[model samples]
Target: MTDFVDNVAFIGLGAMGYAMAKNIRKKMAPTGTLYVFDVFGRVCEKFRDEFKSFGPIVIVESPKEAAAMSQTIISIVPGAKEVRDVYLNNNSGVIVAPKNEDRLIMECSTIDSQSSREVGQALGTAGTGKYIDTPVSTRMQGGVPGADSGTLSFLIGHSKPSDTDPISHRLEKVATMMGNPKKFFYCGKLGAGLAAKISNNYLSCSILLAVAEAMAIGIRSGVDEKLLHEVIQNSTGQNFMADVVQPVPGVVPDAPSSNNYRLGFKTQMMIKDLGLGVDAGYATGIKPTMAEAAYRVYENAAVDPKCIDRDGSSVYLHITTTQEDHQE
Candidate 1:
């Protein structure tokens, strides 16, 4: 394994990945190099112009190119299909890149476990490098705010316990560059992180819907929404959404709800993750009733003009504004 990390590659420069790469580039050693890549050439150009002075920023052409020049590679793409294309694509993927026994590849996307395991197996068979699933949890911490502050928490699924091996120890150190040091979890084997993330997202999405419905009920009963929020925080009904990322606007001054839901977790992304959770539940023979209910709400919000591109919490707007609810 590499004793020191001086060259790192970061793929996928979307909402979360952009902020994470920014922190990595800013905090990296002055002598180190940061390789960046995205499907959009302009995004890579913009990132380089904005942060080139901080450190060496090289915009690569593809995932393989990034992997060829770095000892450690990190990716946080959108979905399972993108995950496969980045790591397993025949012509331009990381699997065909130059082999380095010491290289470590981390996929931080929130995706299905089967797809993650398939990529992990291919990397092991090709002897490309070590692979880990490292989906992040940042909604309660203010989503993009958490990523920008380097305070996001990750659910890591690796071959060994964190810090138990040279590779895992290296993983722990690198993860801290983009996440809270105390919050990264070493959940079991290579695909455990994805499973944990899917289950957790299912619950959080459900919670957001629950909070929204509860708050709407309170407001309709002549109670001030702010007072309702205060009461919930002081009572057992309190949750991360109610207190930190309140579904009701004006309840939390800095929440996405207060800012019209732009630049936060998108409703479509929420729908995708919820569908993944529901699929996992059916695959495991357990019926996720609450997740099903929340999934329907998010799906509806994804199609609504007012909530389509807004934050996941904007389901509050969908619920309050809709005159009729679709029956399951």
Candidate 2:
């Protein structure tokens, strides 16, 4: 077909995974063959249709089927549990499949550091593949453009390292070819990238929660919402949360808050990442005091029907509105 990348496959059709695979097929044209598998058959079929113009797309039944067809695989799933199931599960997982070859496995999911290492270790033990975690972050409020336009950032670490190595270079090459080369940060060691991502997200959720609280206080205290944001954004209080998330809708233009929090990172996903950080804290004997507080707030919000399918930034609105409801 276009160009045969029979060696490359993607193992998930989650929002980001689907979009990245679709765009990579179009732009990179991986051997006119980009094998794909998803737990959802409909998503796989839909992607198979949409991706045909760029390459030969296969809708496989299991992770093993996808692995059999490609020498390089990229997995972008929801979290650690799914990651474990897809690559390590004995029944039909990739590593346990018969006749598997040495492949490059790049994990782009936002999984915990522990899981990353565990998966990497398993691959090593099984002699199945070279594993690397290049967990990425982006404002996925938009669609494929978020990945295609080079807006996503990749944080990477490999299970093995050497000055002159085969695997990491290939991992870097494919990532650079498929994504924005400039956005990648190659952290050392297999689990370093995941640790970095957890810390980064911990700060993100923590600050977003604080921004929500501060914005609610400002609005209730008679400070003009727009004016208060303008002042704070230009002052020492500014962060991505206030500057971008803008918990108060009218304060920022084109923000998720302004759009009813649709099409942005989901509120529950934020709590899930926070949970990973909290788990790390317990493992390391360090208390993630602020993260625990942020976790509690988002945990409470995640269960609220009001926050369902809402953007993570909606946590600010949830806190403010709940407080007002209690006071009333």
Measured by TM-score, the strongest candidate is: 1
Off by over 4 Å in 2: 1-4, 98-102, 140-145, 148-150, 159-163
Per-residue CA lDDT of candidate 2, range 85-106, in tens?
Answer: 9988898888776544358888
Question: Cα deviation in Å at residue 180, candidate 2?
Answer: 1.5
What lDDT tens digits, residue by residue, belong to model 1 across residues 1-328?
Answer: 3334679999999878899999999888878999999999999999999999998999999999998888999998888899999999999999999887668888999889989989998988888888899888857542678889999888889754444478888888888888887887788788899899898888888998999999998998899999999999999998887887798888899888998876578888888889999999998999989999988888889998988878888999999888445422
TM-score of each: 0.93, 0.92
Report how far residue 292 has shifted in candidate 1, in Å: 1.5
Weakest 10 consecutive residues of candidate 2 by summed lDDT: 138-147
lDDT (Cα) of model 1 = 0.87
What range of 10 consecutive residues in model 1 has the weakest lDDT sum?
Answer: 319-328
TM-score of 2: 0.92
Clashes of 2: 7
